[model samples]
Target: MKKRVLDVGNCGPDHSSIKRFLAKHFDCEVLQADGADDALAALRGGHIDLVLVNRKLDMDYSDGVEVIRQIKAAADVAHAPTMLITNYDEHHEAAMKIGALRGFGKLDLAKPATVEQLQPILGSAD
Candidate 1:
């Protein structure tokens, strides 16, 4: 089965970029969610190997970390690994403090380090 990645709260361009990058380099499916509700529904609906939540939701300008917190609070979906997508170190640290794994920024989507970080979760395209 292909790995599944749930991407939450990114804007159109960033979502496209992320989908493109993941499609090019990993044999996984990328699912989209616009907010915490949508994300939680998607998480409970199926198996998601990893979750990448934008630092700030474009849909309503809400805190993405709060979404992560909600996911962590839910017992059924909390087992899924999550990451915060942001360029700021402070934001990354903040997310990590709340049970998120290391995440990559939109700016670093194609970087070597980002690829390395994703490899373990999504593996490589076959």
Candidate 2:
């Protein structure tokens, strides 16, 4: 069966770009959520194998770190791998501290050399 992925992002451009990339390479089902509640609901529904969460959401709510924590705290989904994406360089350390399986800043996503850096983490989620 194809692996499922939950992609939580408030920005349409970034969410669309990542969804396009993943869809091209993997049999990924993308679930776009605007906030923590939607993301959690998706996870509870049982189709998600991995998650790629944006570091910030609408109205400055639901950062990636909190999403990661919620996933880890959930008994059913704790084992799922989470990749946190952010535009802020400083949040890199914070993301790592929160137990994200992988963390990539927007600068890395902008460059082709590092854009595919998420492949390994996504692959491992399978």
Candidate 3:
């Protein structure tokens, strides 16, 4: 079975573009989550191999860091590696501090950087 990725964010143009890119390259199912609560609920549903957090989530939760923090705190999905997607490269430290494994710049999605960063997280560790 293809690995499943819980993509937490709003359905903006950029977000939809990234989703398409992910679907094209990665052999995984991308599950969309609109907010922190929604993301947590999906995590609870099981079979998620990765948790991709959006830096500017539209819901009241505001930031991806909060979403990452909550995912790490959850007993059922804490083991699922979380990554932050952002336009700013500087957010890497902030994401790490919030317990995200790492952060990837959204502009890098179409480039080699996205694959380089995500391959391992998507179960390419071997």
Give me the candidate number with maximum TM-score: 1
lDDT ranking from best candidate downward: 1, 3, 2
lDDT of 3 by residue, 40-112 (tens): 8888877788888888886654888878888888877788888888877677788888678876776787786
Tens digit per residue, CA lDDT, model 1, 1-126: 688999999998989999999988888899999999999999989889999999999998999999999999999998899999999999989888988997878889768778877888888643
Error of 3 at 124 (Å): 5.9
Q: What's the CA error at residue 112 for candidate 2, in Å? A: 5.3
Candidate 3 Cα errors over 4 Å, as ranges: 123-126
Against the true structure, what is every candidate's RMSD? 1.0, 3.2, 2.5
All candidates in order of TM-score, best leading: 1, 3, 2
Question: What TM-score does candidate 1 get on C-alpha atoms?
Answer: 0.96
* Candidate 2 local lDDT, 20-126, one digit each (tens): 76666667777788766777888887867778888877547656788777777888777677778876767767766766665666556546544466555445221
Q: How accurate locally, in lDDT, is each candidate?
A: 0.90, 0.70, 0.78
Give me the overall lDDT of model 3.
Answer: 0.78
| Backbone clash pairs in model 3 (N, Cα, C under 3 Å; residues 3+ apart or in different chains), count | 0
Shift in Å, residue 102, candidate 3: 1.4
Colliding residue pairs in candidate 2: none
